[model samples]
Target: MSFLVMDDGEYSFIWETLCDLQLIFHPKYSREGKIDHKELLGLNIKKVSVMLDRNLLSSLLKLTRDGYLKDEQEMRIIALLMTWMIMNNYPASAGLALKEYATKINDLIEPKRELREFNNIFDYYPSMMWLRLAEGAIDSIPVCPLPTEPFITEIKYNEDDDHLLMHIAEMLHVVYLCRRRELSPVEKMLDFLIWNYKYLLICESTLVYTAMLFTSQSGIKAPKNSGSNDIGKILVGCRNQAWDLNYLSNWSSFHYYEKTMDEIFMFATNDILLKRIFINTYTSGGVGALIEAVFSKSDSQKIFEVVNFNQRNRIKPDFGADPKIYLHQLIEQEKHRVMETISDRGNFNYH
Candidate 1:
């Protein structure tokens, strides 16, 4: 029945540190070698376990009592804390006590929801909130740490993120893996874009963008031996599923959606591969009409102003091409390349 109060900054550090420690101690969660504790970590693990078990049940009860089942963030925090406790090896007694409460949270987060006809991607927020917590549960796994890499270092402390990209990426991995029949093909692509949006800001290599695009489209883990034929199909498959501007316009109204679109603009401005994806999604995916609308909408103009500047100066010099012409050219080249790859695959098999 004890309520603990801490400032956001302190709570964030504690949360991150616990997440890191969980991975550190649980080698099954992370590939990194476990660290031997030099001394007892300051926090009493036993006491915290008890608190999690107690508070989780109490929180759910309070939430229900207040008739605020729609307060997803609160639920998400409770779920994450419970997940963190489980990762840290909460006692059997605590788990048994909290089992019913945990089940309630799980039922609330279960991926299946009433799919509305007027589907905006942001409306999936409750599902996403649950999915992210689910990801935190799963992402307590092993990945090699990247150090001395400017990409990692540069983004680790970006004001926009609180050193949570690694965690976020892991969560996205969970989303990427499970988006199958749970989502439509278009929704899967949207999930992919959202997952890798951060990389569009930092990664300079077109290869990274290309790989991510294909992987997202395929809904399969990227294979090292994937040939040109395999890639061509993925590209074609993704492009064929054009976007709906209605969805994008609806998406734009959400708070963080702009950041994702901004990343798309940055990606398109920086690399031809991503530009093809962006332009295809824009023209075919229904964002083109929205962009036109955005231009006249003063409040929304900032979204594209920086992107337009870069497209005009940087992309134009590289291709000396107008956006419309450039988009068409890229589509044609991709078709030619896909055909060539298919032809090559056929000839190679015959030979």
Candidate 2:
């Protein structure tokens, strides 16, 4: 078979591979739209290390001093992963620094484990994903596969990317909540906080962390004026860091971050997914007395399923006398379907 030609399966795998690879590419990002703020990618290890989270730098510093680590291999692996995540999520001044760092760190560490020639995903995952994405693209090149390209109206990928920015902003709100609390047994709840430091970087290998008060007592501040618009900062971070669409970077002579940030702020404040059900539950009375309805003798609780963000998606069964039946009725099949559908509605691409 010619190397240039690809099968259907091969085409499918390419997109999946790109998704996987893109997960770890750390993009250089900032709130600024100046020349320096303009994004770049494929950074070198040194520059990545410079921009790394302080805690990550500290860990590496100690590792250098101690000259040993409990699981050197795992530690090195995490560092490599961060390099990619950084490239994918943030802007890089250099190209493919993460891959280079992984190789270098792997060689430098004890029990020197060279990346296997052709087996583990970690070894050649980035290259494989890139290849697949290329095969799937119309041009069969490694450039962005975003549809709705130039000389037209706004793009679908543009909206999707914007929506994702909002999602990340909401997720950051939870992270802030976690940071506010005192350090306890971690992951005791949904937020996963319990940190002593303001912004504690805990996860080994990866530098993902949270800050108690990175800005002020109120919380994260931003260039924007609105209170709800604080999430603008988070979106700003992602925009600056994300691949291709650098926030300040001049992509095709267009610096879109300023416009994108405003759009992101609107989405974050509106919270489309939350509002969809809120409108129905509070005003329409659609979420009527759940338990009472389910328990009612006439209600068919057996067939109904509850569709709640926190609740598991499953059928709730109850006999005529069962008290929980009414609650189950509250989550009727129709409600479940609507809620499920609306839950994912914010994912719509307005592009």
Candidate 3:
């Protein structure tokens, strides 16, 4: 077979053009009245298709104003959306939430849902890798224009994400439409930012840490070990990169946090405890006391992971508890855990 390659710049333009075209012909998501097909049908349909994208764009803009985390249920959805939006430089992707940018604001929104049990959330949304925001991902915002491509990237109208995106977008629209008159841009944006939920840095850590807190002593890849180190690196790297100018600038509705890195350490330590407990319990205990033991050992990570991520093994789609949850939870949990631990060490001045 012959190999043909499309250049990055060329493919990007082509992809953008395709999406633009889809806005007209397919009209994937036209706003309330930007386009009346009846008006266009009387004339040439193809020629007037250019206006289709504008309507879709308007609709998305309006949707972003809505409250993502209305409650616990909405919090789960909001977390997933944050993960998806931030996984890529979604802010730059017209009419969509800037994942990394929104993440910072989401991060700032305290009392947020703890992702410690993200593994459990994974049961519903499989790719926990994208949701667990690393300190680096948030810190890296100043250096926007992500150096790497998105981890879980997808176009708006692709086969797998088409329905999901549309549904969520519509739901958000309904939310915004309700408060349209009362709230202005600044108010809506702030509301979206402070959408309060718990933040779980522990249970979200990787597998190596899964072995950390459970044992009396640390091990090969303990929170302070080799594997956890890599996890920390990725978390911080991703968070930092998210804020980098290479991705979105300060004005991109995505925050470029140049200040403190405090959360890094906090998230790391907690993630380690959570991962260890969840993996131990999610494996054999299969929703039993062992799960509580893991939680007991974890303190709050277990509960955070379960309630926020797993929804307490309530994830639908029947993926069943197995090695993936073990690995994914451990890996992601390890990610934040490592960063937090290393960050804590970095702040160590007394030693």
lDDT of 2 by residue, 143-240 (tens): 22222222221222222232223223333433334333353312212232222111221221111111112212132222121122233343343322
**RMSD in Å for all candidates:** 20.9, 23.4, 23.9
What lDDT does model 2 reach? 0.27
Clashes of each: 7, 44, 62
lDDT per residue, candidate 1, 1-351, as tens digits? 122333555445435744443322211122121222222233343222122223334443443234333555455554444333333333212222132232334432111211111112112123223234433432221221222211111111112121122222322232233323456433443444343342222121221232234335333233222233454443323322211111121222332343343221001011123223333333422333433332345423543454445445442223234444443444444345434544654742211
Candidate 3 matches the true fold with a TM-score of: 0.17
Error of 2 at 319 (Å): 32
Q: What's the TM-score of each model vs. the native? A: 0.24, 0.20, 0.17
Ranking according to TM-score, highest score first: 1, 2, 3
Sort the predicted structures by lDDT, highest score first.
Answer: 1, 3, 2
Better of 2 and 3 by TM-score: 2
Tens digits of per-residue lDDT for model 3 on 26-113? 1112221122334433443222112111122222222233322223332333333334233322221221223333344543222111
Q: How far does residue 200 in candidate 1 sit from its true spot (Å)?
A: 15
| lDDT score of residue 52 within candidate 3 | 12
